[model samples]
Target chain A: MFDDRSPIYRQIADQIKDDVLRGVLAADEQVMSTNQYAAYYRINPATAAKAFQQLVDEGVIYKRRGVGMFVTAGAQARLRDGRRERFFAEVLEPMAAEARALGIAAADIVARIHQLIPGDSR
Target chain B: MITTSALQVRFGDTTALHPLDLDLPGERIYGLLGRNGAGKTTLLSVLAGFRKPSAGAVLFDGAPVFENVRSTSRICLIRDDGMVGDGTDNLRDVLDMAAMLRPAFDSGYAAELLDRFGLTRKQRLGALSRGQRSAFAIVVGLASRAPLTMFDEAHLGMDAANRQLFHDELLRDYLAHPRTFVLSTHLIEEQSPLFEQVLILHEGRLLLQSDLDELRERGVSVTGPAQVVDDFVYGLKVLSERTLGPTKQVTVFGGLDDERRALAGRYALELGPVAVQDLFIHLTGGVP
Candidate 1:
């Protein structure tokens, strides 16, 4: 499932976050135990546990003591808000740089975006 | 836990293993990687108390390993060619023998594994094919339930489906009963994901030991214009380099620091992550 060059735990953490952002994993829904995740992914349980621990530390997920992990309340909204800021910094910034290097004007970039995106989406 | 201090193995005039030390914690899966003649089998055998070290100390937990009944009982090393009994031995009797020798042996589990592998008790060990024998080794190794189980290419001749079954069964069994497992195999990429820690042996020496994830991050690949790539990797530990027209891809032995990353960014060079198999090849003299 993880094909990236990043650490497996980091890939898993990002995947969980993606799932949460896409509404595949709803807030307040319990996630699979690390062992179950490991068995499903065919990886070491320790790697899965590391990813879960990262989620728990970030408050994206919480433990219910005896029960398994669950997405924290408002975690989706919080994550989306955080990602919105990063998208502009990491993605838009590089795109703007590339456009400038290619001698494309800011207005032309906006025009191209308009041609690709629907008017109602704005 | 398993510990070794300056362990060495010598046969006749040649040294199979130089002085080496390893302290492995309990209940984690470790992947042992090396080319042939890298002393992988020698290391596994020593760890399992099957072969004596010519020099230095071997410890299982806190006790001496070689010939120590208490320590030896906790280990099970399955060699590809060595089963529990002679070739004429019936499969059923082999399980009985394993159950008798290993205190943690689970006959019920063994039978279940055998059934899943499509093997029966009526067949003699000699009558089974090579793949079947490997499957049988896996059955015994997993069912032995030894606290420290080592498989030296135990999946040697099995078909891909059977190998998949072995990995799946191993993961499930390990989840239920946690124990230290040392798997020595040439099938690096296929089995790399299942390891928590990785140990690479080279020239009978302990080359590197690290968390599997950390090891993955150690090797970095950069692809850019040939001239720029050549200038960029100057003085860096370059493991291997490939050139296609003007674009050159170089695999380096260490992570790129912030300065190096900035340099790559300035030139628009693509930085790619290295897989464990690629790193193994570069590190073990397997790649030209």
Candidate 2:
């Protein structure tokens, strides 16, 4: 659900990114044209274009001169890198802080991490 | 933030709204769009507290807004119809009254707008041209500086040049001090650029709410041989099409990949951007 609290373009960009992650949109695949998206969703075309432009700027999508936009060749990899860069603040830091707050020993946490690894039954 | 829930309004037998729900945030510009009699004016009036909803309520930051001084004073609705006064009053008196009542009013801006529109303060309301009256209302709108500003087709009487001036000034001022602005108009192509978000009403019902950019990318126009165009558009959501002799023009919605583009190009097909107005017509046209 979209709340009016944030700019709609940012939400649209986030949704497109989610679509990429889910493989609903594939690399080298064409993305929707701004006007189509606008009519489909009944939004202003400029806001829709802003979302696509954001994706293009981040190398997640690219435009062909006379043709429409396509998902970049390494869009998934680029998105992975972007996500990895934010992992600490977005995931690890909060988990670590919570673990520390629970008074779980560092050794125990390390052992748990090791046990959770695949093919590490021993 | 402004929130409306199950908001229904009726003007005698004409139902203006149909139990609609919407949430409008502060510090941004919104284009409220619809055809004539699409309830745009009625909706805006409810939001600005000019007219109360027959059923349902409007809340500004979790509080009722109708006749509520604290919230009402922060808003100004510049309607297409000139602002009404208690009784007969000259244009000069109305401006003076606005200066006295609206705490945020900018007299300098008001003067400048009047000068730009070739309007003199001494003219009586009954004596001004329709275009001149519209200009005066717009001047009040821009100068009011209300946090939540609503302009409901305020430039209907303006010529192209003056309309452009109003748009430019609106953007310049909005960029300098961001606020919640709701502009309801039918001229989508002419004023689409200034809209950060768009809310569309269809037959007094909420049809769509979306960003302008996304709407642009969701559709493409393809023109080529009828066979090739038909083949290319196959399985896509074709909004509209026209064919003449061997050529066919197809406007379709959905994402089209480079492979498809290449395939179409191989058949000598031409692909291009669809204008906002055309796209809107295709999407909101009578045919489902």
Candidate 3:
């Protein structure tokens, strides 16, 4: 769950972003309070709060003061934009390198992607 | 800063702790893990100034803590025995005392904590169940928020849910205000994540004190065909091993790099982590 190469809080923040983009969490929706997240995840609340702070810094979430953290009104768009920017590093680049090693052409992969979208006639 | 020099403790003929030295920097949660009678309690007691070391001194910020009210006031130690006071005192009095004496005490938070723990102010400390006592101790430990707070098995009687609550509250309170928290517990795996640094004691001796994250990265487990794993582990320190059917799992403590990984892969060996508890048991000679 934790890697030595990077701070755990950053990884936690990244995971939260992935969740937000995947629609596992909704914008303007209240997220788990830091204490709730810490206990639920069995991690230090400070570390959890750091992760939330990272989201706040990135405008991915906003704090409601005495209440708790809520996904911002445009949280989904911000998350999608942020994730799209990193898609190549996180997904495409690795897949492309592996495919090249396997002698699979980029066109072949694109064809597979379109084939998997059964209703996308275009 | 907290420093102990040549600290020694002896209970009659049994030496509880040998002459030792240690230094703890400011504002970090330290996990003091050891088996029973491994001197955790003794060390914490001395550091908290509840007991004077038989041979040596404990200093807080360069000043001796023993009999030093100013220094002692900055520290709160919650042990299984609770505080030495009128056991008849209701929980409210204890909270009041904490709020009045502890410079950083959070009375409002303490009240909320009491409610969360289902402990009422009017309840006498003596009348409370063991679990309730544990809860009460934890409340004091968290709410005190002293510069240095030590909890020595302070929640031994708490149920799993309440223990979870205790950990959550501890972290939340620490974040709200950072301080030095030293927790001594036998439940290593349960509390390992809370620790930035771990000080492990074995048979009254300081075994290791290192960054918990780094300690975790020092060992790896390799499993594969018996011959391959054996060859890879040859000349390497084997901490433990288990064999069943056609495969063997060997735990080796050392570096595992890309080269080692490729070698293991070539030999059809699988590499994984050695759980902290299993490693601790191996390190401590299976003490309790």
What is the per-residue lDDT of model 2 for residues B226-277, given as tens digits with 9 covering 90 to 100? 9878888889999899888888999987657989987876786888767666
Show model 1 residue runs off by greater than 4 Å. Answer: A89-122
TM-score values for chain B across all models: 0.98, 0.90, 0.93
Clashes of 1: 0
Measured by lDDT, the strongest candidate is: 1
Task: Judge candidate 2 at residue B34 and give its lDDT.
Answer: 81
lDDT of 1 by residue, A66-118 (tens): 88999998889999999998999889999998988899999988888888886
**Between candidates 1 and 2, which one is better according to lDDT?**
1
Instruction: Give residue B116's error in model 3 in angstroms.
Output: 1.3
Chain A in model 3: its TM-score? 0.83
Candidate 1, B27-89: lDDT as tens digits = 999999998999999999888888899999899889998999999887999996847578999
Clashes of each: 0, 30, 0
TM-score of chain B of 2: 0.90
Best candidate, TM-score-wise? 1
Would you estimate the TM-scores of all the predictions?
Answer: 0.94, 0.68, 0.76
Candidate structures ordered by TM-score, highest first: 1, 3, 2
CA RMSD of all predictions:
2.2, 17.9, 6.3
**Reference contacts preserved by each model:** 0.64, 0.13, 0.16
lDDT per residue as tens, model 3, B1-288: 999899898889998889888999988889998877789999998899989889988999999998999999999999877552368999988888888888888888889999999999999989988888889988988888899999998878889999989988887777668899999987877887787788988888899997765677777888987877898999887888889888999888765778888888667577787667777777787543
